[model samples]
Target: MVRWWRRPWIVPFAAIVVIFLAFSIPPYLSFDPARSRVPQPPSLGVAHFWLLVPHVLFGSVALGTAVLQIWPRFRRRHPAAHRRIGRVYVFGGVLPAGLCALTIGAYTPYGPSTRASDVVLALLWLGVTAAGWRAARHCRFGEHRRWMIRSFALTASIITNRIWAAVFVIALSPQLDTTFHGDEGLLSWVASSAAAWLGWTLPLLAAQWWLERDHLRTRRVHSRPSASPTPEPALPHP
Candidate 1:
């Protein structure tokens, strides 16, 4: 299974499909947008709205950047373009995502447990974004790569959320009558939301760790050299 997914096309194709579904499907869902009635203050001022607009616009760009980073041909041919797009992705993708993390805490439909989980996830998302930005600024290519992997994993949570929601609805539908009966609607909503949060983020983090293990090991080896034994002094007696 691991070997199969390692094929260059598999990840990019999956990422493309996931990004498409993430932007397209949420509007149609009954629970989205409308559930949060009491609006929080916008983090960015009105003038910054244009900057925030790219968050929605360039989600596909973020996914495409991930593909370019992995694909050798694209990386070599347009290194400058890749760097420019990466800047766009970090600023455009991560900055707004961090803001949404702050606002989303108030809007969580589930109880405190889920809201708290979201808070942690949001912090993790922002932390990884900052780390990635710092790595790039320092010209640490390996660090930059690993940090971006983690960042993109968090970003892909949007995709995972929907996939989990669909699965939850299918799995829990039959049980609705027996356990929840009339209250099944509420139960399903809570379950789906919770599943969406964990299902997407956790596996992605795990995958990032796995993929970057060798790079991380190489870094550690290069960082510390073995102490060389002192050369023996020439024997004066000879």
Candidate 2:
């Protein structure tokens, strides 16, 4: 039986979703008050708009390439391709996106909860990607894999955040009147803050747990003693 994780379609499906969102995000990329997700008060002017472009662009690059990097068969068959994509994910995606994120996070007009979450995710994403790159350079493939998993989990958060927001709205629709309206109410803010905090964190924790479990299973297999053939020497002596 094919293992669930080993299913050939899994990575493709995930990649499709990630890429679809990456392409779809541009329509909403405007800094105009009508399209912006966050309120753009007068204090946050053209500078905020400029920073957002790289943040979204490189962030999309990170999201789009991460699945290819993690696709097991693809990585095995095209190691050079995997390395190239990894470089794109780091240099082309995470570095510019993360730096932009730090600036945006500091100046976020949203509540403190969101600012904190954004800053934390930005720093973690950069640090984790850098660690993975260093591990690969040092030829520590196992450590590299683990760190990359964590970094990709953060990359995936961009999509997960939107998904959770939709879920929160759908679930709380009856209770929260402003869910459909343009105005942000107390409930909406609470849900947004909670999603911000949980979006990347839950995925990172799951990835870490999966990596740990796989490592333990590998150790068990390595430590297991192979059975040797029973002695047939008695007939030889005779």
Candidate 3:
């Protein structure tokens, strides 16, 4: 069912489940205080909690909205409803994710290596969301499609993370007696993290670019007229 995957909500819902499972893993749940090299401010705990709550809440809402976004009948029949859901998706999903990105240190499980990617991830989330929203507002349908595709790509990182982790552990199982061998485990984590970023986002961006290429070309052509230049006045017939 390739068609099923095209359904907006299906992919997003799947992403949510994948993310939930990834975070539930023991590695993520057990926070290591010593791992955090970044110094905390007085409000670090409060900020962390606040950031975390919204990420979960908005992420769920975004999944729901994605389903609505893909329903052809709903989009055609009730454009206003679609717009409303879109607004919710933006405010709920993208905004908090961006904020959390800014507070990258709060999520680092083990110092710089863990948190190093946070800035890029956060910026990607916000950039996609903002671009999508702006494109929709301007009625740039092609741009809108591209931006939304990119945004969802980033959202799918959660799923990618788990997939990478599973694959890494399986491939290296023979070499390491245990999955938690010190250097190997760290390397595994790094590899999985990198895969998570590339696996989901890059493909989506490529697909969006390919799909919208013609549309963008059409827009550009229409934007410029092919009218022949009027011959300059014959210098008042000299």
Q: 1-238 in candidate 2: lDDT tens per residue?
A: 3454778766666867666675656655654535655555357776776777678778888877887787787788899999989999999999999999998887776667878998999999999999999999999998999999899889888777877877886777676655545555666666777788888899999899998899999999999999988977656555
Most accurate candidate by lDDT: 2
Tens digit of lDDT per residue, candidate 3, span 1-238?
A: 2455466666566566656645543332334433332333455654554455455456656655666675666677899998998898889767875676567534654345446555667777788889999999999986887788777666656556557657866776665645456576466556556655565556566667766786788899999979898887666555
- The lowest-lDDT stretch of 10 consecutive residues in candidate 1 is 32-41
Instruction: Go through the candidates in order and give each one's C-alpha lDDT.
Output: 0.63, 0.81, 0.64
The 10-residue segment of model 3 with minimum total lDDT is 32-41
Backbone collisions counted per model: 0, 0, 1
Runs of candidate 1 with Cα error greater than 4 angstroms are 1-6, 10-15, 18-61, 216-238
Task: Judge candidate 1 against the unseen true structure and give its global Cα lDDT, from 0 to 1.
Answer: 0.63
lDDT of 1 by residue, 1-238 (tens): 2354466675666666666756563542433333322222344333233322333345455554555555555556888987887787777656665665555553454555566766777687778878988988899977877787787777767666667767777777777767677586477566756675776567676867776787688789999989999999988885
State, as a TM-score between 0 and 1, how close model 3 is to the true structure: 0.63
Error of 1 at 16 (Å): 3.9
